[model samples]
Target: MKKIIFILSFLFGFTSLYSQKLSSNNSKAIKNFNEAIKLYENYNYLDAINKFKKAINIDPLFIEAYILTAQVYSDLNMFDSSIVYYKKTVEIDQDFFPNAYMFIAKFSYMTGKYEEAVKYQELYYNHYKLNPTQRARAKIDLNIYYDALELYKNPVPFKPINLGPNINSIYSEYSPALTIDDSTIIFTRKVPVKDKAMEQEDFYQSKKLPNGNWELAMPLLGELNTPNNEGAHTISADGKILYFTACNRSDGQGSCDIYRSYKIGNTWTKAENVKELNSVSWDSQPTLSADGKTIYFASARNGNMDIYVAHMQKNAKWSHPQPLPDNINTARSELTPFIHPDGKTLFFASDGHGGMGGYDIFYTKKINDTLWTTPQNIGYPINTHKDDAFLFVNASGKYAFFASEIENGYGAYDIYMFEFPKNIITTPVTYFKGIVVDIDDNKPIIHAIAELFSLKDASIAGKAITDIDGSFLLPLPAGEIYALNISAKNYLFYSEHIELIEAYDSLDPFVKYIYLRPIKKDQIMVLNNILFDFDQATLKPESYVELEKLYNFLVDNPNLVIEIGGHTDSIGTKDYNLILSEKRAKAVYDYLISRNINPQRLRYKGYGDTMPIADNSTEEGRKLNRRTEIKILYNN
Candidate 1:
């Protein structure tokens, strides 16, 4: 009763026939047509195409031969040849017009001729009311075409309606695999099935109806539906076979193994565990490339869950799984890898590096046939503090589908849809810009420490020092929130929060201005905040945490340095105050010493309050005046 995942595809079948009676006049035509069928069955579609043309030439009205030839040319990806023969078939026999229209619609859709495809599909439906099954399938494909049209022509806001009780239960259900034609949807459902004492998860599927709703779901009964967990599946592009994950059992190679099932007639044959894939650890979340030649998935056998890929051999056996390079997988988890339909981009979830949260969606592009560039964060709005994974983008690469925990969502994790900004979706770039200044004067303040914190985790993402003109620029992947902190001594710390939500195709400057206030004695301040230790000439461990503010102030104004002086009230003997204050002043001097401040740039004196701003009679006044003070000795 393990969860059995079924990946289904929609397929339409047509019949082929040679000339019924071999009359002397049709003998050469029959011979050519028979040879063409043999070549078509063997998948020598291009060669079979020429023979079919010869047959049609011998008998100008060989309609069935024309239909078969068009199908073969379509399979060979020669859409122009396919369209010619299909049109010719209908010209010879008007009764075959609906079938011809269907082929033309499909070819048009494949070639991105949406308007033409829609026109032809509508014609097919109007001329011939197909059987219940054909109509059901046709409606689903029509819906897909319409969806594709909406995705391309308009930037329609996405409103994801929850599947509700009919499709979702307390159990899990996800990872939908659709046929290229979109007539059928196969998704994984985890449902508890009872078998004597034990209960386990099992896979079930529902078919689309002519009315656009789904039919009642039922289990896929076959050898593939085993008593062990079998979920996470993918189907080949042509819709002939399914590749899925099956857990370790008496028949499995390891903890979880990849398996495949071939379609025969109307049912799937016995499942065959892919012996070439499984290792001792774990391997799952399989995805097949659109061409059906490459398979990508997650595996922990090489240590953590990293993405790996395999190739389909000429004989249809899979090669050994090869781990993706370091650019894609670090010594951390990388899962739910998806190879987009475009075949150049790969999207996956990783915690390795350069991310906003624990797990964020990342992508890498194949610069050429063999080279993959560095991975990049997809960015905010689409990514959040919570996990954002399991991504799928359509052929046009406009809208994308992923899971998120949006407010009022249907479940703990509900599927959400989003669009990449038109510019970034087309072309992408990196780099950020901003400005810093003094709060009181409103003048630019250079050399302020600007630390960037990731809003996803509130961790320090990066740091940059403002330049001479009080401007800073940093490189960042588009789509994120960052906290910028600017601080300098004798100045109030400045903070600016920025969110880069919009996608950009080229370098876009994020104009920002920061203001910092001057620090003075009347201003309430945290003392240990400035760091000084007890009974010691050496600065405390925590000293620089605050003193760095002073250091930065000096760095910002190279011609400026103040006298580091310490004062004390009458609590101690005047001699003791004089000597202790000298030590305290020197401590500040030495601490700045360790920081590479030139001795020529600093000086120290112990006044012991020969000049006291507050009365020593009160404890508060004594505390205030018996303190450290820095006066600007020089300013340029």
Candidate 2:
């Protein structure tokens, strides 16, 4: 009844004259009222409104005509005139149109007259009997309006800036997705297809200008687009892969199926259905993890539309989809799940959970693989009593982007970003980017995984794989030191220690190049991270991280024997340097032996001031010269 009342209140308020004769006996007034009803039924609202006013002028007591006039005005979006007619009818005779209470309440509620709406709503329910569904909805809306009051009282401090004319157009733009660095935004734009009556949605992208404003959006020039619609997409943190929604396609498994495309250099490959994740129902609105190993999306496969997640298997396949926990997915619809690059925080929209009403934006933190904390609303103002979903945030967590059909927009809907206060920002992150190539031919190495581990605790921090171009980016929590190990089949593992504690921002990407050497003899590489006490032979505790990498390499190649060579800068007497370098080399050999490596397979040697790879005249060069290196001696 609440929904019907809510909608009807906006339509025409009417009297309970179902079995009675016309109350107004004026023949001309009755004729005009009948003509007005026919015009209203045919959706000629302006003509119906004029006829209704004519009937009222002839018979001022025509309450039904007054109700019809209000309905026409409301249909025209003239809420003030609509409310005036509704109130005039009430003043003449409240009982003549008891349903007018509900109509007045609806107009009041829409115009920020919450208290008046509530007052009139109570009068409506008390006067009429409600069915079970109506009562339940009424109760829910009542509580929602009360909550909305509180939300309006205390709003979150946000500054939303329009993306400007370059990005918006006379057509609708919505469902904005951004790269980890916020350099590009892809959105869906509805445009008329020249001669066709039906509008089409296409994927459009806007590049961020040097001044930071987005440039004019253009349809994707690659084969990712077709005559059919393509929308609701999320870009991988590295901006290499796009996951999106396409409906009613021949290859689709349901009404809407999730599709993906890979970025080859600057062009996107053809779209392919994510067959593993799609079902015979709706499966759309996908979000890819920062590491590109997990997919989160909304699906109705489980009967109720809920958020489901799947993992990227070791063979580069998707795992079986599993619905999120009850905390995140309720019996009602839950959609638009955006897992932030940090991987712990999740933002989505839900109508099932208790909210201000309709679908409201919410956020939660993943407690573990199968559990998440109860969602908290992104807050009022940002989320109104209408449907609001599809929110994306940058790696820095400073701003959030979403679509809105707000006033003064360029068209139907425009994308906007809100600067979030510190309270709502998630954990800060810094992206580590690099390219992987084969040293033999300088060709790109695709699908190589870069595993990041925390040196402080040896915990796995994050992972990212090289794209077709051998370029990779990993978003790690800022202010930490990590040990990054790159792995690929039939290639020797590469290890490096990175310290990003001083990089307090996520905007500037840190780049490093990795040259993967093939598994061959005579391959010599430096372990510049191996450290020791000042001029002493004892290894520092932090040096164990690099030693562990050596240990693993040895364990992975059991039959191989390596000579651990230590080099010293020309800082002391040659004789003294040789003795110290030999002890440092022995320290590494001893650690490997302790890790169960055969003592006979390892050899320790010192080349003091004899094999300096860099100039020992400068402090930086001297630091690089005092290092540990490994040489492939034999593999049988």
Per-candidate TM-score against the hidden true structure? 0.40, 0.75
Compose the digit string of candidate 1's lDDT tens values, residues 461-565: 445566667766543434666555567655756544455666542224455676665654333222223334444456555444446655665676677656787
Report lDDT (Cα) of residue 592, candidate 2.
91
Runs off by more than 4 Å, candidate 1? 1-159, 195-199, 208-213, 402-636
Candidate number of the best TM-score: 2
lDDT of 2 by residue, 287-366 (tens): 98887778899999979989999999878889999999988898899999999887888899998775555688899998
Best by lDDT: 2
Error of 1 at 447 (Å): 73
Q: lDDT of candidate 1 vs native?
A: 0.64
Model 2 pairs whose backbones collide: 1-134
User: Please, what's the RMSD in Å of model 2?
Assistant: 6.0
